[model samples]
Target: MAENEPWQDPRLPEDARLTSLEKRLKQAQLEDAARSGRNDKASHKGRSQGMRILSDLVGIPFGSALIGWLIDGWLGTRPWVMLALLFLGFGIAVRNVLWIARQRPE
Candidate 1:
């Protein structure tokens, strides 16, 4: 209400009641997730798998291109070495993806 004071939302009073309600709600949600077999571990495993795939798809090619660029710069071969390594990196990435696909879920 003051010129410089921060205003609080009336619907969400910061008090003991709100804190207790929040704790209860979180507990209920967690219990529900566990009962439904959709808990954090399952989601985390899915996210981890997705991240691994993403890293393999992007990191390998980019890393290879970077190394090839450096080599090209040193050897004065311009784009030839870089292109070759970039393609090789793509091939490796594909192979890794196939390997991952064949892996049994943990």
Candidate 2:
């Protein structure tokens, strides 16, 4: 009700409220980072590397197996071609994973 009290102003704009919230959220994040003593950049890098490796490990063989199955069906060779392609895919996946693991972290 007082003229000097901005806190009691019911007609404050939405943008002002959003800006205040953003500032407080940023402050809280800074405080949390200070308390945790962890490097977010390093963790993010590690997480990305792990995700890349995982995708390669899963995707390469699965894709190769699917292709091999299709080829076997077309050629009427049953499981032989599929098995060979699957093993080839597995070897390639292992080699890629090993290469990724050996790379120096940037």
Candidate 3:
């Protein structure tokens, strides 16, 4: 053969070349899937954090006061139970906010 006639290495057979190409394709697909999964996980985490913050901001006091009022109304009690539960709920909400803040990435 000529010195520069598109020198072809005969060490690798056609089947070997095809197999190598297939492996490379599989690796590329797996890498893409892993990257996509990471992005999805990050988005899910962010959404969950936002929801937790919103719930803590709105749910605790409302839920506690509502529960207290319902219980008092059913049992014929008055402001005592309502006040206690409202304070309890407020405390719990503050605790949750602190916890969430501490858990955030710096």
Candidate 4:
């Protein structure tokens, strides 16, 4: 148990200890990177999904309503066709959002 008796110790050599520490450090770093990578992927997925939901929710309805308005103008249908088509667009958008949500991975 002498303080300066490391060389005499019947244990791992200094190089072996250093190598073991290096291995542990490398493993820990890899594990940390893997954990952070998973988190990044999860967050990125969530953000992208939110954007997709927003787009599906807004874009489809807007496009449908615009088309409906154009058709109404061309057909001289007043408000009847335009309103019906707008509601149809909204319903389709809702259905799509629900379908997309259901398709998400657990």
lDDT per residue as tens, model 2, 1-106: 5433657567754566668889999999999988986667867877888998999889988988999999999999989888888889989989998998887554
Which scores better on TM-score, 3 or 4?
Answer: 4
What digit string (tens of lDDT, one per residue) describes model 1 on residues 1-106?
5332356565654678668989999999989987987766667776777788889999999999999999999999999999999999999999998887776444
Off by over 4 Å in 1: 1-39
**lDDT tens readout by residue for model 4, 1-106:** 6433656756644566667889999999889979866555667777777788899889887888888889899999877777887888889989988887776532
What is the Å distance of residue 10 in model 3 from its true position? Answer: 47
Among all windows of ten consecutive residues in candidate 4, which has the lowest summed lDDT?
3-12
- Give TM per candidate: 0.61, 0.63, 0.53, 0.60
Query: Which should have the higher TM-score, number 2 or number 4?
Result: 2
CA lDDT of 74 in candidate 1? Answer: 100
Name every residue pair that clashes in candidate 2: none
lDDT of each: 0.84, 0.84, 0.80, 0.78
CA displacement after TM-score superposition, residue 22 of candidate 4 (Å): 19
- Identify the leading candidate in terms of TM-score: 2
| Residue 9's lDDT in candidate 3 | 66
Per-prediction backbone clash count: 0, 0, 0, 0
